[model samples]
Target: VQGSFKADIKLEDFVNNSAAVVQTINTWVEDRTNNLIQNLLSQNDVTRDTRLIIINCIYFKGTWRKQFEERSTNENADFHEASGNVSKVKLMFTKEKYLYGENKDLRVQIAHLPYKSDNTHVQFVFTVILPEKGVSLDSVEQKLSSKPQLLQQILNDGYTRTEELLLYLPKFKMEASFELSDVLKKLGMVNAFSDSAADFTGIVSKKDDPAGLYVSKVIHKAFIDVNEKGSEAAATTAIRLTKRRRLASDIKLVEFKVDRPFIFMIRESHNNITFFSGKFLSVPLSYYKRALRKIDVIFLDELGSEAAAATAVIMATKSISFRPKPSPIEFKADRPFLFYIRETRQNLTLFTGKFLTPTNFS
Candidate 1:
């Protein structure tokens, strides 16, 4: 609680000046999140019955160790969805050395991309878990849910090797908001949400006054942007006590193309803590079918047979010689996938999301 701050707002003022109070809270959220999130709470969110409001915000900005070249990003790359739909997306490409692993048992390919950190003791990484082409992301999620240790194994035991790879990842931005009272209730924390059963003697002494306290609503909002440079993410959570609610590789390397839907996470390398995790399912209404470029073929109809034959021979001789290069192993994630952001030393997940679609495209 060293960095924690507390403030008291009169209930009368909160109810009378609801808009101002909401603006004050939103201003704090915007400041904490570098303006990435705004209007976190509205008039309907706060009420006179609300005894207390607690909020937490986290913001992160990290640059890639070896960034993707802006010019190398393909503006119209094809992303294949799980439903067999295709969308045009901004795809990033790079060939560099990176920590990588493959788990046959899990049927997944893992790649670790480290971020540049000023603190030597702190190392942040973006990890992508791409299921084998035929494997469904749901299956992988089910397996990880069933045996959480498998995720640890995937992070610790599986990624010991480094390889050069051709990587393709999409540039995406996502903003998500969730009302988590029901989710928390389902997790078996019912008493806190129950007005009759909730005990708030610790927060509000019964001797002082006894309407008691229960969580009314729990809302969480998050935002993230991943591009050629690195990533910027912000998240905020507000708990109203009025209710018992909660609220890249190089030459000859393997190819790791995230052209499909997959799983991704950002973590601190030292403590193996996951900060954010989510799946990129699909790119909303941003689907585009690239129009085939029309090529005009001119025939030498006016040329004599002998002349045409001679021209054909000359053209054949002058044709550019194409050599077949060795194809690196391709790890294209053309479908949906997941991503996470975390702090290393404390082993805390900062952000988790899925980039199903591109929010911005040129």
Candidate 2:
């Protein structure tokens, strides 16, 4: 989704004021999304001096331009990926000159539309699958013979056609966040965020001798819903910056596979960067459905017995790990704590419920 806008503001000045940052974000969203989306959170929440700022938002609105008509959509269309499994998906067939592009190897069409406002932008990328089935990702590199040409074609080529058919797609929503550090680091952008990263010297006036500080956290959320009626989705990204002259370190992606039921905590020491992580429990899904989920406590007394077990386990685990020794001894049997829990086809009360006193359980 995207909208149209024209303005130029200094990045440093925008970073200093929370309101400015939010307004800029809103503008970016509107422009990028082509006005298909809107900013829900007020601008004051995101500020320069603030160590951590939360950007909570949702996009329940519909699309400004419907690319695929209901009559031309094909229901039960098989979306066969590189894998052997075939997923029944709605086939939106359009010969329209979307942001169309192609080369000797690949044909990628990008559909640009408004998101309702100017805070973010999204492009619908339609890539033609060269290989019919059994996709080999390793071979994909060889397939894109001319990426530049393909990009150019998508930007300036193609035709438009509409028809009558059925389209059926499952609704989906995802909430996620990224530490700006990780994003920058991924882009080979460590130099701009390091201790000696002189590029940021202009962020403040002289005389304010800065010490050790780096980006502390990132938070994000995305939602998508589709049913017999239609489909709508949106995502929000937030960054938390800390003031310190810190060095960029190697990113160690610890793969905590939640194959079995286990409890973990997110605190200052564990380096747990994610929050509110979770998995979906389809009928066949076991603990193996997803890798890990970040947990937080809510409604302790009313959480019943399950919440108590998760709390105890998290308390016991956090106390022994980080620097200065977090005092898990303070964790009471009644109060709730935070920890990831694995669900199953059967009952998943692996380590919870015993802590509740006898004859007093709810």
Candidate 3:
């Protein structure tokens, strides 16, 4: 029941002082996320019609139980891209005992790296899911999407043993932002976003207004940084009420080199709550150089009414765009992979994303 709610701003301000409103909301977002997430809202995202907004923000920073040696990191390590290209990246190396497992069914090597936590009830672990070399990550994604329980099964049954491992994980930083109204609609959540069908009478008394209220937009932004010391991540989600709409393991010196694309997640050990989950499909710009050589742009315009003569104009332009080995116990992630953070007790996912190419390298 504990929460933070703000209702002082008037709907008129959303129209007349949108900039100020946006700044207020964004500032709150930035502060809550330790400045890791900023500008969660723009003026265009708010209007006079907007009646309410709900926001949630989370920030996490964890040190590895056994930190990587700063000097052991390789700055020029070659990371294999899914596109068959290679890029030089900063990869951190460590030798440590970690929880590890392999799911032959999923064709992935799993590694579990625990974070330093003083509270026993709040344990967190970072998990990496690396698909076997030459396996398409898309296929794995489809299976996971089709069967959500498969992920839980992987975490519970796949990683059953502890092993001493030589780990090579990339030093990376990434940020992502998404607008989810359409996505929600496509997921069968339609009534809340329909201007005419939305029902928010419980949230607001709409007896006097025929238009009532509906969701207009949902915005989400996230950031994460992984380095020798540990991991830092933050995410913010805002729901605008304006409209109705809306690791592996290994043991035995078994090599688990993650030199290709894979999936990952962070979660709480006890509850299996995943905080973050994403895939990293690292593709170097050079991989797309050939495609970038040619560029095409197409524009179409329709003129005239239904009863009148129809005229169409078409314009075209062209634009173009575009591992490792190891010991049996080694788990080197030199390619794209997915990762996430989660709370063990509550089984809540905190932050997750793919480690494609390192932002700096890209």
Whole-model lDDT per candidate: 0.60, 0.24, 0.61
Please provide, for model 1 over 59-134, each residue's C-alpha lDDT reduced to its tens digit, 9 standing for 90 to 100: 6676788888888888888887777778877788877777677776667777777778788778777777877777
Per-model clash counts, in order, read 61, 60, 63
Residue 277 in candidate 1 has what lDDT? 62
Superposition error at 121 for model 1 (Å): 1.2
Q: On residues 16-122, what C-alpha lDDT tens digit does candidate 2 reach at each position?
A: 56676557555554444333333422444344434323233322322322343456444444433333343333333322222111122322111221112232222
Candidate 2, overall lDDT?
0.24
Worst 10 residues of 2 by lDDT: 310-319
Which stretches of candidate 2 lie above 4 Å from their native place? 1-77, 88-103, 107-149, 158-177, 196-199, 218-221, 224-231, 235-362
**Each candidate's root-mean-square deviation in Å?**
19.9, 23.2, 15.3
Q: Give the candidates in order of lDDT, highest first.
A: 3, 1, 2
lDDT tens digits by residue: candidate 3, 288-332: 232211111000001100000001111111110111232446888
Give me the displacement of residue 342 in model 3, in angstroms: 1.7
Model 1: how far residue 282 lies from native, Å: 0.5
> Over 4 Å off in model 1, which ranges?
1-12, 235-253, 286-329
TM-score of each: 0.79, 0.36, 0.78
